[model samples]
Target: MKQFWDFGMEQAKSCIFPVVIFLSLAITKVIHLSLIARYDLILIICLVTQVLMVVTKRETWDEVKVICVFHLIGLALELYKTHMGSWAYPEEAWTKISGVPLYSGFMYASVASYMCQAWRRFDITLGNWPSTWVVCALSAGIYFNFYTDHFIYDFRWVLKVATLIIFHRTVVYFTVNDRTYKMPVALSFVLIGFFIWVAENIATFFSAWQYPNQEQGWHLVGIGKMSSWLLLVIVSFMIVATLKHVKGKMKQAPKLKTEKTSF
Candidate 1:
């Protein structure tokens, strides 16, 4: 127990900056800030964490660089939309402003990238295929972007979602890594996704959180949660396929088995 506690303490040391900054901000104010200001903490931590990550894991820099760039690209795209006022962060995090919070977008991605890699490594070393599936599934599902209240008339997000669903898979098929689009990963992503849906319904119903565009026919638990999830699965597979093709790895593709396995 003492050894366990010591290891935890070391882990905490690694996250000191993020922990302190986020806690201070959380205490100072959670809502009411403009999007940019609200996310100042996030931005600060991301920059700091990125620095620390390089300092500690100098060897894995190549792998880190890939995801970091991918994530940053996504952030830039979001920034463009936010700047155009196509979508606004109506809920202020205790600061006053309109665009999406800066820290939220950038830092969250940093943390998520690290977490997914850690989770992936963990699975590869011990749990074999199941662990990898869990990591990929959960990561992809969250990024699937279905619950974005796509029907919200404010930004025509619904239209964007529709357009993406129709065309995004093609983009993914050309962009993401090849070893990614498979049944184990897809199923894991699907199950966790439904779990999240179930959780969100509970939250919305209880008023713990609000879904502003609940009136949309796609909300499932609002309109089409299942359909949205299906779209997500397709996109994730496409992303993996595209990535594989880009690396000239599609020539020898492995089949994704959907059969039930006995543990």
Candidate 2:
């Protein structure tokens, strides 16, 4: 019971920033800020929060860089998706560019932020990670599918199969209050994806963005989006793993399993 409690608390601590940001965005819609639009306010809050994380050492500089990568990657997708009519921001703001508020990218960055913070806070490690090239290629393929699927045959299922093959043996390890815990890496992605889907519903409810069908009124985002989020989680995880998980000559070791972080 104590272990479960501690684990839950640790999860909550790791989730603080994302949860707070989402709820604050939802709540901010109710408050009228005279000079600034709600979307602009969100952007300001996100930037300040990111700076504060580094200022207080809640996140390291490397982690911040990883988060920035997520931001840019996400913004690129947002630009394309918005152009393709995937979804849209209904409100007007000075930060809007091609119908996407700059702050929207932070939603993706928040996931990386959570992952990095959770990794350090929980002394997380990985085992049986697939080859760097294979994982990187899979990440790239998944990302490409997000755009190319609209124009040609969707290869998401094929990519999903490839991911399963590569990650079949991968496991994530972490410590919670001195007792070690482990989970299949794929399962973690699915769990996180589901929660992100839930958050998406909430974001839409608060008018963060709307789909074609949602223009009339808010409705649940299709269940299919969870699959997309799962793939995205993999991409985000791989990028951060490249920075934090890969280190030194451990790459040369055969069957690299245990992490070197002296946990």
lDDT values for all models: 0.41, 0.84
- Clashing residue pairs found in predicted model 2: none
Candidate closest to the true structure, highest lDDT: 2
Ten consecutive residues with minimal summed lDDT in candidate 1? 171-180
Error of 1 at 37 (Å): 3.5
**What is the number of residue pairs that collide in model 1?**
27
* 1-263 per-residue lDDT for model 2 (tens digits): 88678878988888767986887777887887879988999999898898888899888898888889999999999999999999989898999999999999999999998998888887777878877888788899999999999999999889878888888888777777665666888888889999999988998888888899999988899999999998998888888776764653123222324444222
TM-scores of the candidates in the order shown: 0.43, 0.92
* Model 1 lDDT tens row, 21-43: 45545543445444354345445
